[model samples]
Target chain A: MKLRRIEGDLWEIPREGRMRVPGRVYSVGPPAPDDPALQQVANVAHLPGILRFSLAMPDIHWGYGFPIGGVAAMDAEHGAVSPGGVGYDINCGVRVLTTALEAEDVRPRLHAVTAQLYRDIPTGVGAKSAIPRLSDDALDEVLAGGARWAVRRGFAAASDDAERCEEGGRLSGADPSAVSARARTRGADQLGTLGSGNHFLEVDRIAEVYDPVVAEAFGLVPGRVAIQIHTGSRGLGYQVCDEFVAEIAARRGEFGEDYATLPDPQLAAAPIASALGQRYLGAMQAAANFAWANRQVMTGLAVRALLHALAISERELGARVLYDVCHNVAKLEEHAVDGVVRRVLVHRKGATRCFGPGDPRVPAPYRAAGQPVLIPGDMGRYSYVLAGTARAMADTFGSSCHGAGRLMSRGEALRRGRGRSIARELAARGIEVIARGKKTLAEEMSEAYKDVAQVVAVMDGAGISRLVARLEPMGVIKG
Target chain B: MRLSLPQPYEDLGHTADVGVRTRGATAEEALARLVLAFAALAAGGAAVAAEREERVAVEGGPGLAGSAVALLRELLYRLATEALVPAACEVLRVDAAGTEAVVAFGRRDPVLHAEGADLKAVTWHAARLEREGAGWVAQAVFDI
Candidate 1:
């Protein structure tokens, strides 16, 4: 269980006890001695056909099977895909859009803008969408076509919205038939709605620019207004993950005795070529598409809300997507393994894909400067924008930390925030926060999360991602 | 009604999610209590009056753990789609195949009944349903 400092900003757990590979953690310093994330990393190494090492970003924290901020690449020919690696919220991600307006222009109307956003975008537990419910056929199209469906339906500003997303906002293998009717029923009316617990929509300002050239390329300049949306496939994704994990675990007897010895039953997996695996991939991809479409629809909603709040036209607002990134997902990508390039299924659970500059996968507009990575911090503080690096490709499978990871449990946060006015606290700091209830505000206070600047600094020092800009939240809406 | 002496469930600490541990006189009783516990958490400690009933059927191959997860997921699905909160659950039958139950739930009224943590899913992580002495105990972790 001892983590050895193998190099600067890197630590390793030597292979032992049925581990197929060593466990690697990217950190600015050694992890706390009793951190459960170390054990989770080691547990992931026990997975079948894990290549090189089971990796964790500096934001690593204890999770069910794979630690949050964990990354692993498994050989497609021999490896298995586990739902736990993608977590329950399939394709949970962040999307940031830039506007022509500057912070000074919106500062005076922060309250009105935030209120309009809250009114237009539904939030809270089981909040229904402002849009009408989708018919079965429409829902299926959304699942299969992803953000493309949104663009087609006029929910997106242009086709470029799809182009700016990972997988072009549509996973090619998504099979609507693979998804269960129950999941569809749960998702039918939830599009464009933000579900509770850590999901949010924030209006921020580019507070500072680090790499001015890259920032300009990303359309991020100091004092400019930007909007960030964080959400996922909603109830649909959770049901897909739940059904598969149970199905695979129930069939463990058929996977041979080796399966019975897995460190956690929740780590249930099937070979990539197996029937169950193919079915799961189809369903997962469909959920991923649903999420992309969800965010896309929300983007349109946000634009309308912002324009309405400011009593301006779309031309005046000039809202446009900067980029969208999926954090919880698994995809087949070609990567160099032991010096030979091969296709592998990369599982990034609470980790973002950060393809370096010049990679074909990077969106063409940003190909020369790498993909833009959005790291949202907790309310009442600053978020970050970073660009991928070549070192990320060579060392960490082109993945980086997702967000400012949780530093306290929700219960602990609530207890600590007891009798305190979280809204007043934020307002005093010149930030406006709107939520359905006070409990969510307390549960999500800034103290509950690690300083995102510190987390980004670790990634920057490790050379996986370099800073581009810092965004300070001016107004926030939480679900 | 007028209830028992010992509390059937208690909340356990988790780093990022919510966990519950329940005890009952039998496995069926324990499963029922677990359902009520889940409902309580979802209801955010609001007093729920059972005014309606919902039937749920789930199948698991062998162990009690898989069956428990299936049951919990069914409850969650119903809650998400129908806005019903279970106040009580009666285990109708249990076999090697699975369990069938009828849950009595409260009507959806956001004005009168506020929502609590929005549980995303019930995970199988470290889930346990076992016999301890002459009684049974069950534990589950929920993604909120």
Candidate 2:
């Protein structure tokens, strides 16, 4: 792979072969020669009607077809839509909430709060639902309504939570009928439950504020305790992607004229105008909606547990959702292309939308500051809150890195963590770590990830997104 | 006290994903062994009792890889939806195109058995079945 420096934390793979666009990456260090993610980036460039560049964020890492933290936009009318691009976990996103209580107030009772949360919120594989099983009609409503459904059912911590979410929680064009029966069955019981593997509920405190103005605008007060929910559409999302990716890959010839030439079979795509593509879009949107509602419902459960454990009234907690942003998704957005603005379906896998100030799509309350980009780091260290910037819109389709990318494989992490108590290790750092299995914690130890500060610094240095505040983890519950 | 048999497949690690590699004297044996390895993983290494038996079939493409994927997918779907863990997989027949196998299953008791990894989907990344060292070896990666 040939790499060229493009000034200031940016690198490019010059368009060659059957590539329709050049490949771009934001990182302090260039990718290794044999990195599969490098090839994955180049392969994305081969997609039809790709615009500007097949872009990657600073925390880029090896994912199945698309590199995690990768972003690409395609011409709506002339391009392809790959289920693989959005990933199996549709709308796997982060929700950040600000609370009135300070870290000092919650530090002593953190363990009780965490234990109550674990008991209140279902965790682990085959975890039962916290809410009663939904009827078929209600399931359809959830598929279509997203966080709005949660709010209606009183599963939202705040009334305006849905309003603060990306696309107002429910994605437009969701066709519940498009969602398969198996997905519905699997997802119906998963609402308010936290699924396993990298999914978590974290309690954090604002340790530093970089942009005080923006922080104030978003209600992120320094030293205030906050909550973060990291999850997705769960089995529902996975089933939808699995069905479509396999169906499209097997019937690739029927979906596109040049399907056989796809750089990777997993990168199989359908023409945006094709029936299969439309069907996938409808189903994917449904899954994305389910995830929003899922997160919102979990928020309600966690907030309840916190209030109970602290023996405080809801008003006293003063919790308000700041923002909910999806990292894995594809959205039709208008962006500048070749000196002209046009609509493109931007695929963000392990990436977050960071629309700059003045975009009407941004919620009204924080419109002056820009959309809040939530990046969840490892359990031990700190997470970040960034504000979208005009440079982000100009450079990477209003996208930014999601988190500290994996530096080592899960196997490697386990091999290194052998005989060491990861929980005690985190406890020594003043972080209460509660997980079902030690293996999961070991696999997710901080050493398994790159320094998140470095990853975010690249985007900040590149002027794409700016840091607003940082949240240090005080406690964590991994499903 | 029991003597557990050595696993046919070993962990094949990637930078972000996980997989299994298996070797057997024949393609059928290799495919069957691959099925057991993944099933055991989904059961979190718990010993599944052979409470019932069923013959499973999957249409194949050109080689063992495609058939293996189809088989694993069917099993994954069953495990996720029905909690049916394969206690033993005996490949009745296998060819370049398709496969037929008899699997002994244990109805996984959530309270009795260990909870397992969510085997989201069986992906087609680097999946293959080939002859190596006078034996058949196969590998597949699951999207976890």
Q: Give the local distance difference test score of model 2.
A: 0.86
lDDT of 1 by residue, A1-479 (tens): 77889877889999998989999998746688688888899989987778999999988887888899999999998888999999999999999999899899999999999999999999988888668999999989999999999888778755589998877999999999999998998899999898889999999999999999999899997898999999999999998998898888878667666666788887888888889999999999999999999999999889888878999988889888899999999999999887999899999999999999999998999999999999998998999999999999889999999999888878888899999999999999989999887888988999988888989999998899999999999999998
For candidate 1 chain A, the 10 contiguous residues with the lowest summed lDDT are A252-261
lDDT of 2 by residue, A245-335 (tens): 8778777877546666887777889888789989999999999999999999998898899899999999889999999999999999999
Give Cα distance to truth, residue A65, candidate 2, Å.
1.1
**Segments of candidate 1 deviating more than 4 angstroms:** B1-8, B92-96, B132-135
True contact recovery of candidate 2: 0.53
At residue A122, what lDDT does model 2 achieve? 89
lDDT, candidate 1, equals 0.87
lDDT of 1 by residue, B1-144 (tens): 212212367777676788898987777778788887888778777777888766889885447877787788888888888888787788775555788888788855675555477877998886778888888888888998
